[model samples]
Target: MNWETLIDEESLALLLPAEYSHFALPIKESLAVFLSRLPQSVQDRLVEEQLALPVDATLSERLGRLAHSCPVLQKLGQILARDQRIAQELRSELAKLESMPSTVPLHSIESILMQELGPLESKSIELLPPAIAEASVAVIIPFREKNKPQQPEGVFKILKPGIVQRLQLELDILTEVGSHLDSRLHDLGIPPLDYQDTFNQVRDKLRCELRLDEEQLHLARAARFFADQIDIAIPELFEHCTPRVTAMERLFGEKVTDHNFTLTTEKQNLAELVARAMIVQPILCKDEQALFHCDPHAGNLFSTNDGRLGILDWSLAGFLGAREREALVQVMLAAICLRPEKIATTLLSLDIRGQCDQALLKECVAIWLRRMREGHMPGLSWLTGLLDEAVKTARLSLSSDLLMFRKSLLTLLGVLSEIGANGFDLDQIVMCEFLRITVMEWPGRWLSSPNSRSFATRLSNLDIAETVLSSPLIAGRYWQAMWQDSIERYAVCANSR
Candidate 1:
């Protein structure tokens, strides 16, 4: 249906805030640096987009629209199967089920679903089931819809237990979430990606508490969505994701995140290694920017016998950009260095609230920054205090990614603190290592050193040069024209209006 073209026009109104676009000081040169790498086709597409979009939009607004309007995400697995290996393995497993007795239960479950959800919105149970309940196994069952019997996803899967019932309930809710978000965005005339964090949280809670296989399966898919793809489809797919019930079977591996068992000096290195790996992860996995591994938690990450890190649980992920990732590292680095103002600035830059008590925010920033700076995980005083304040004051909803970022950070820090990371300095050699890597690919100019007066001076010069160059060619023509002075202009324009 050439959905990309269909959506591009309407998406601008939501993405470009009216207040931001009308600013005379355009950020073109900065944008040009980014645009140079794009293909001619994409550039042409973007040019049309930029022309239609308001000139004074914020970077976030512009980037947000671009993210959701892109088409590739909508058509995942359509071109060639990116995960052919995983798909093939799944198919083989299903085949093996046909020859085993375990196939009976899955067949029963599929039968249970077909009668419930209808033929559409369901994966085909055409494949057989698993023979044994391996530690972590995912099962797909088919069914009919309670309302409409004819949808594509009536079929579903499980990652834990309580599959069939929970998903039906949750799917409807997510659909509503998507619908309401869709309506609000449509009103703004912007084609935007709906936030999936809450929806995925519900999905994760359902999986972890219920221990359903399909829930975990969906989580894995969510992870895959963030980890490997940057298409708009991730949100849409997640919006319509049907879990019904999922069980995430425990996979066997050397447990990661194990902080306590008074380790021998020999094993201390392994513990340190796992701990170090946690920090290095965001740095090492730049190539997979396409995916968002939202949960790099100890429980979710494991080390194999061969020392390869195994990351599981991908149920919630968004297509995060490089700038966001870089900002994260920088914020942490600043925290370690006890740079309170820098940390406050970075946090606010992440869109905490456009205008709040800057001093208060700095105080809060300093508190947390101090903890991370000292490599200590502070108590709930640092976290719940703000969260409690925001909730009490108003329903302050920040980016859910920011929420996840906080959760992961807290979890990591809390673990390190509990385990006695005596010399685990946040501003240690690792900071320099990450700093070099970050500088190597810092996406935005915002990350440069604060004390670099020379760079600042050059930027000031460039701004002046660009402003002079961009002087309107419309020059004295429009400048000299009186407002509605021409009789023909007034009469003709009035008539058209």
Candidate 2:
């Protein structure tokens, strides 16, 4: 694909709003400079392909088509599809990329399997005709083991042929564009953002998705973490696996967004299950590091027949260290208690450079609190909004892990809204999960002094201690706020009457 030609002046102009037209020429020039640096053969190939490309009428269509051709852009589209902030038309167009049609032929997939896992016949594996599913970077082929009839059918997730080269090329383009943008932010009339740093972070994450070995490791670790949960199902890894291909137990169910439920109760239950699996459990996990599914799009999540939430695609994940986890918990606690000052303090502490304006940070926290009190659900949106405001208002720097987690949560919230779970009180859910963990661990925490415990155990105990000491005060404040709200409601009712 000729990205430079495809992302020509017209396409770039279409991407930017009319008000931002001034920014387009610089971007185009930057892209041109980057493309010129490509090898002669690569440049020639791109030039050859330029004439063969089809044209789309609208911007959305063009973008969707481009995403289909470029895996990196397809990933960006998938993320944007779940974002409500984007234009509905664009979101709808990008959403189609989630269930991209299988462009890779069956023979190509079969060849990858043979190359990676040797002959299917030797392994007693029979590859099913046609692929069962296809995504941005890989195609999933269902296969059955002739020798293991008792075992469930498995699917081989094979990377698309030449994806590595294509993806790396696109990533390099993005990096070049980001660097240019970073240097020209002032001329573009946009606020200064670490565009280079941001793209580097994104590049690292996308690169991780290329490695199936890391995904397998994540899957194994997640399986251990959720070992006791009956409601969650992690696919079991099969022996025949490679970096380009992974064999795992095939799960059967509809996408959570697509599932049809006869009852709202069922939908609500499924929503809570999604919440627990994606948000609550990961946040309150006892492990030293909490592993979160970075991509929780509808395509990656399934509503299994056995009433279990099947979380698939472990390729991209985020890990929160103990300190980060505790900080998150503290922020949640403060939010639930409606303590804006505490929230500000917690956020400022995270700014290792200590450059944030405390007053401005407090104001931002207060605004978030006001929204929550006005019935905005304190879920990912609320938390992310607070962080974003902090960044804009106080110039606070947040960790990349939290930013990645925010993206995951944003995607999860989009899924929840699709399944009618947006109404679920996430603030209440967080409080409940925290209390459950505190109560469950109280005995051990009470028996052992903080001094006797290991560093990780001490941190765990400290979390419990804070929760134990704050619950009553938080409860009292919560009731007081509820009472005040109820009284106001009564007054409004009386006045209407």
Candidate 3:
């Protein structure tokens, strides 16, 4: 953990692409200044560097290699892959980390299982040769019940040794960076984030993801939430488990990431199923148990043999309360109706961590809506992008869960993009889901609520006849704007090519 040993040439090589090597002196000087200001304990902890690389690799190549060497970096690469804020080319490069990672040794996994399940039960269970899958957090190995070798009945999620400890170290370093940025770099015109708070939220989420016990609970909760949804599958958790080990029913399916997964069903039908699971149903469900799977990356979603969607690894699910749900519904309604004023109002009603200018928020929302009408962006992207811009320009504070929700949408979209299904009309999907919920789901919530005449209820009850009559006019205007936008986008693409 000595600083001198850790910051050697090899360790620093992965910090940037080799073409930028001339900038290394300035980077080193800046780091020296920053490290001088930190406590010795923090500096000592920071001395451990996971990245070791040759000096000639490209940025993407270095990142991919670093991700293989470090779980924390792998997680960062995964996030970067979905981040539209980053350059699309760079994001595309990082997207390689989204694929299955190399697994730890079989002996290491067995030792952990033995520790968790006791030696007897560990021996009783038969782990299939080679892991079924691997990722930043754990290795998934299919297993069979005692004396039943016909097929693997369950899967053991065995946390890699020292993974939790590694993540803890990384979180500590991240928290330090967040604190340093907030305290020392306030004048840098960075966004209005309380980085410490955001880091804390992220740390909590990572901790949850690392805990098999917590994942088990999340799976059960999500299963109950989607119990009535026939097309969704949640693998059942076995009672035999530990904090770092979980036994769950082995879902027989191919991940959407697999090359042959699309062959399970027609592309259009698969697209619909994905949209419903990742977008439509999650947003519109009125049930109190509803939760958002905050990480719907391709690795966590599958196309089952029965032509249904299978959800795996529910480690980072997000819950929205009644008020938050109502606020989101209002925001969606405003965005759909092109009412920026309402969008601003609903956004403000949610949790805000700092002061903000209401006027600036409204103006930003208006501009965002204008862009959306021009078909320049998808619904969720525009919504989150506008919010992010407002946060930077107007110093507006937003909720952590809201940020996670936005991240989930972007992640889902990124996965969809892999199969050229990125062009799915989000507007149409949201509208259909909204109408379906209004007619089929909202009535029960409305009738049971103490205030049946609330604005939400009234909005839901708006006359379908009037909407029907106005449809032609609305459709004409939208299509005209979209056609123009498409032409412009095509021109840009052609020029870029």
Q: How well is each residue in 1-497 modelled by candidate 2, as lDDT tens digits? A: 33455555665565555655666677566556556655577667555554455544565666566556557768877877866555567778888877766778888888888888888899899988778778878888888999999989999888889878867776777777778877877776654556676777788888877899888998898899789999999999988888998999999997898888878888889988898889887777767788898888888889999889999999998887777766655676678767777888888877855667888788788677767878886764577688888876786876777778888887887788778754676667766876676576667766766633323222456555666787779767767777877797899999999
Model 1 lDDT tens row, 251-322: 334444443346455244444554444444443344434234444434345544444445544544434345
Order of quality (TM-score): 2, 3, 1
lDDT of 3 by residue, 1-497 (tens): 23233234444444545654443443343334434444566544443322334556455564455455556567767866755444455566666766564468888887887778877364577777588787788888878778555544898988878778767766666676567557744454345466667777777776777877888888888888778889989998875687888888888877664535444246556767777777766666655535888778776788888867899888788865556666665676566655567788878877466477788877787677778785655455566677777776666766666678777887776666554454566667766766665666554654654433233223433433445565666666566656866897899999999
Alpha-carbon TM-score of each model against the true structure: 0.38, 0.80, 0.76
Best by lDDT: 2
Worst 10 residues of 3 by lDDT: 451-460
Please give the CA lDDT of all the candidate structures: 0.40, 0.76, 0.66
Better of 1 and 3 by TM-score: 3
Residue 475, candidate 3: how far off, in angstroms?
A: 14
